[model samples]
Structures are given as C-alpha cells and as structure tokens.
Target: MRAVPRPAILGSIAAVLFLACVAPEDRGTDATNLRDPWAIRAEPGDPALAAGKEIFASCASCHLADAGGRSDGTIPRLAGQRAEILEWRLRGLQDGSIDLPVMTPFARALTEAEIRQVSAYLASLPRPERIGSASGGVNERGAKLYHDRCRSCHSAEADAVAASNAPRLCGQHEAYLLRRLEDMASGNAGGAGAARAVDPAMEAIAIALSMEDRLRVSRYLARSECD
Candidate 1:
C-alpha cells in the first residue's frame, strides 16, 4: 500500500466521527437520481473535494485510503472510476436497486452531496497497476472462455470499461470476480426483492457458464493487461 500523510488520514478519520454526531436531519436526503451525475463537478482541493475526502474516511476501511481496494478482488478498485458510474451505482445501492450486503446501508448513510463529493475524489485518483492472477499464471481455458463469451462487451483489449459502462475486469482480483460470478450464476447476486434489468442481464450471462468456466475466465481476467 502507498503511504499517506498521517495528518490527512487523521483528518479523514475525524470527519467520520463528525458525521456520526450529525443528526438525521443534518445528514441531508439520500441520493435518488443518477441521471445527472455531472450536476456538480468538484475539482481536487476544492471545498467539495475536501469535504468528500473527509467523508470518505468511513469507506477507507474497505476500499483502502488510496481506493486501490484489495488485490484479491473481494472489493473493487474505486480509484479512477468515472464519476458518473460511481454516482449511478451509489444511487442504486442507496435506493435498494442494487443490493450489496454492506454497501446498501453504507450508501444510505451518506447525503447526496457527500456521495457526489466522494465520487469526484475517487475519479481523481490514478488507476492502480494490474493485481495479476491469484492462480499464478494465465490459464488457456480461461482465455478461450473470455474470447467466446466476454470479449464482445469487454473488448479484446479489455480497456473498454468506461465506454461499455461495465466493471473493469482486467487488473481486477480473481477471487472477487469468482465470488461475484458464483453469486450471479446462482441467482443470488442481489435485487432479490424485485426485478431489475441490470441484475438479470448479468445473471443471464453467468448462468450460461459452468463453475469451471467461471473460474477460468475470472483467472484469465485477473491476469490480463488493460491495454
């Protein structure tokens, strides 16, 4: 992990404590609309950016201070994500459209302004180097599976994450990818309470793969280069 300045880190921690003391009314309303993520563009060092960094202290535990997330893929890299995508996903989580175990409630805790601010902060950071495969080496079977099943959307170069509005697979952690695939394949990847177009699309794709294929593809992606 990259070393961060102690003061900045401490300030972020303090912000978390401050947010805790804020009453429900002071916390502001939950984010409900994702259609206008660019409603506020906060540059680094701006007041919005500063506030966002402070509020993000609570998230650092899981996402890491640099937002590099875990190399094992249990969490995703938040750094370098598009602000629009972050806003959209957070809104979905806040409203229960996306039903992650921890993120659901975590999203609920933030006000709309804080969410946009943090999203801006995350988008400002540089993307990390590829995490590489947990399996130690590329598996040909996995590569083949990706070519046939995933390449259309992810692209052969695997650099179309933002263009496709899909998650970054290249440089992602294998274990995390594996677990998510398992969940999607098993029809347990969230939105269990109601139907949503996004949830079903992924599930349909995952359902076509056997467990072995899923493992192979995930490992292949974990080791693949983004360029």
Candidate 2:
C-alpha cells in the first residue's frame, strides 16, 4: 500500500468543492461559461440597430453577408429568424447550454445591447429562396411522420414559421435539420434538451423521435419548397 500525501488529498477535495459549489455565471467570460448580464431584448431601433450591422461583419464568413446561412445544412439559416428565437439561441450558446463551438465565441463577445441588435438585424433579413439539396426518393413516410407529430407546432406551411416561436423547418437544409433533430432526440439541444428544457413539451416530442424518424422527417422537410 502506498501512503497518499495530505496536500494532494486536500487539493482533490478542493477541486470537487469548486465544481459542486460554483455557480455557472461565476465560471468565466467565455461563450460557454458566461451568463447574460443584462435583460435580453430583440427589438431593433436607433443606435443599436446601426451598431449591430457593423458588428455583423465578423459573422459574414459562415452566415454570409445577408445572413442567409449555408444551404448544405452545415450552417443554419439565420435569415428571417424571429428575434426571440435568435436571442434564445445566442443565450444558450453564451451560457454553455448549447454546444456550438463556432457560435459560442461570437455570442460571448457581444455586449447585452449588441446581442439585441444582432438578433434584430438577423430577424430583419428577408428569407432566402430554398436551394438546399434533398435526397431523391419518395418522402411520403416522412411527410406522414411530420403531419402526425410535428405539424401542430411547426405547421405544414411556410407562413407558420414567422407566426410561431418555433423556427421555420420547411425547405431548410436537410443536413442541418438532421443535426438538430438528432441533437434534440439525444438530449443535446439547448432549450429543447434535458439541460434547460425550456419547452418541456418540445423536449417530450424530441425525445419521442427515433433516429430513423428524425432522418425521414428531416429529409422530407429539407426537400420541400415554399409555394
């Protein structure tokens, strides 16, 4: 038997205590560690709106200058997203609730006002045309799955996206949709997961989806075009 040093034992104990006792907000200022220090608003106006447009230059790389996002489903479409949805997404990233590495740093860098402004700016963009690629095959099963489970909240039509708090899924990139569906089902989604589960009902829905079901529905939605 080996003797354990008292100092080493005490240090291990201290580390455990820190992990257990420290609040999430006190951790650090990185996107995954910091909490929103001010009230989060999404409405755009005056000085903040202008400032946000200026700040958006850094985000243009992946999101595009128009914030239309990539069509391959690798990056999500931010264009025409609701301000509230944007705010929630950014907040989740900032607070470590969402695990998007690319978004976390950008969200963390913003001030409270900047968050609001950026959200508003993104929300203000006109939605781009649906150009993402979809699998070539009959999607009737996937359509049925969506109608049976997802239609009530997400709706079948494009207009429903703007009216509801939920983001538009129809005609979105298939890969992106698949990723989100899988994340939600796996309890890794930000608000839609076990960690925050801000929408517990949504969590229930997500949890109920199997991997096959997610793929089917995502492919169907991704292939859809707005009429």
Best by TM-score: 1
Estimated TM-score for each candidate: 0.68, 0.61
lDDT of 1 at 178: 80
* Candidate 2: residue 88 lDDT (0-100): 49
Which consecutive 10 residues in model 2 have the weakest lDDT in total? 12-21
The clash count for each model shown is 0, 0
Q: How far out, in Å, is residue 192 in model 2? A: 13
RMSD values, in order shown: 9.5, 13.0
- Residue-level lDDT for 196 in candidate 1: 39
lDDT of each: 0.58, 0.55
lDDT of 1 at 21: 14
